[model samples]
Target: MVADAPMTPVDIEPLPRLARLAWDRAPALCASRDGCADYHRSWSMLRLVRAGGKPPAGWRFFHAEIARAAARGARRVLISGGADAGLLAIVASGFRNAGVVPRITFVDRCATPVMQNRLLGAELGLDLRAETADLREFRADGMDLVIAHSFLVFFETAERARVVANWAESLAPGGALLMSSALADEGPGALWRPASADDIPARKARLQAQARGAGLTPAEAAELADVAGRVWATRPSDRTGGLTEAELRGHFRAAGLAVERIACKPRADAPALGAARQRRRAEIVARAPG
Candidate 1:
């Protein structure tokens, strides 16, 4: 993973309990807001990392990919922990109204937004269910398609490994799991926690190590480092902050997923709400058999 050379490495210490609880209070705040969710849902992720590069083109790109899978006899698609549901909506619409339909399901931790999505789906007459539980519970077993859209980076280091392990275990052989995440210029499992220069590099490295213990070789580790670079560049104005490249790469390797394609860009609409500047990605990782 690409990282800044530490001028001097010092022993790191844990945060105070009160301070730690408040560690990501801001991200939680952002997640709770409507405007923020809307902006991010509109491909704001493309704005970061790809200022001059191509925009995400939205989940239409993913829909086309899924269509290809259906043509090849794939069935059942699962999207885990996708809070915004924009991508889920597109996928569900395509499957329900379009010829290349797959059974669509969605899982999220909270149901407030998900319930709203379910109502919207009802109005559209699409059969999409949003469950209030960890994504790990969703099973696309023996199903033709599985998708983890912008889902992997939601947790901390150990959580990424567990997330991958669960997803991997759930996969059916020859049933491809479509996994996507907006990597920072750093690593894959990065969430935009407000970080100080003094704190980020070390914590990032530790997480990277945790990822390594989970899987990725050193070389592969560095390769995954490019996820958030586009985001950092695309939205220089973002107060939420950018990712360190090392952090992005380290997480992918840890998850046992390789970088299949890394297309850097911003959305044409210049949106920045749900989780803007999403680093475009498509990765196919080896799933261990049961």
Candidate 2:
């Protein structure tokens, strides 16, 4: 049996009352029209991060493997966060281009993704199902590939361990999990609330300036700002965090997964996001025993 992993250092301050309430009510809250709008806006913002017409950096990191699997007729995939329906759609599009049709299952607790997937999946002609269910209560078996981006960060360590264990068990022998998120050597959970009024605007302005500096036209910058605003609507109540490489490796081992490949990219704005002295964004691929 794999030993328990060492816990990474985390700031254990209580979440704000409002944040706590929002977390508790997220499922219901996100079932509304407004929730759909929030997700639509977030995906638009995500496009800027990926520089349009390209897969997000994280997805690009593992696309080759996914395509190879599809080529081999291993076309069953589960994208764990329906909020990531956009990613699922993109993957499906890639498969279509290669003349391979894949079966996809997109799961999330929020209704927004479920609604979005129906529309998007139909438009893309992908065989898929979007499920809205609490991760703890969700179950599946024999998936060939699982993609979960920005999903694990929502849970605390013990809960994350449970969730990963479940996903690992759900994997078909030799199935793999591809995930990406930010990680820190030392810090509170990766979720960041604004530190102060001054800090918030300063960070926003810096991001805008960076966009402009990247040669984005004024109109493009304005469009990105609008998308960013919608995404920022939940920043005050965000509940996301990450683990160090060592911590992540330990977690994988404990969950009965073998680390297959891993990569990290230093974020230029890590400090602005309230990360500790050393934080890096990470992508990992792990596999179950065949």
Q: Which candidate is the best by TM-score?
A: 2
Q: Could you give candidate 1's per-residue lDDT for residues 70-145 as a string of tens digits?
A: 6666666666665444445556544533465456666666544355446545655655666666654544455555
Worst 10 residues of 1 by lDDT: 6-15
Scanning candidate 2 in windows of ten residues, the lowest lDDT window is 6-15
| Per-residue accuracy of model 2 over 1-290 as CA lDDT, tens digit each | 21143111111111122222322334454756444544543453444343433344565555566666666667788888745345675566555544666788888776655655665677557688887777766768889888887666667777778788888987899898888766656654444323552354554565566557656667655555565555665542134445567767777899899998888777654455333445566888899998
Which candidate's lDDT is highest?
Answer: 2
- Residue 167 lDDT (model 2): 86
Identify the runs in model 1 with alpha carbons over 4 angstroms from their true place: 1-57, 96-98, 136-140, 186-262, 266-290
* TM-score against native, each model: 0.50, 0.69
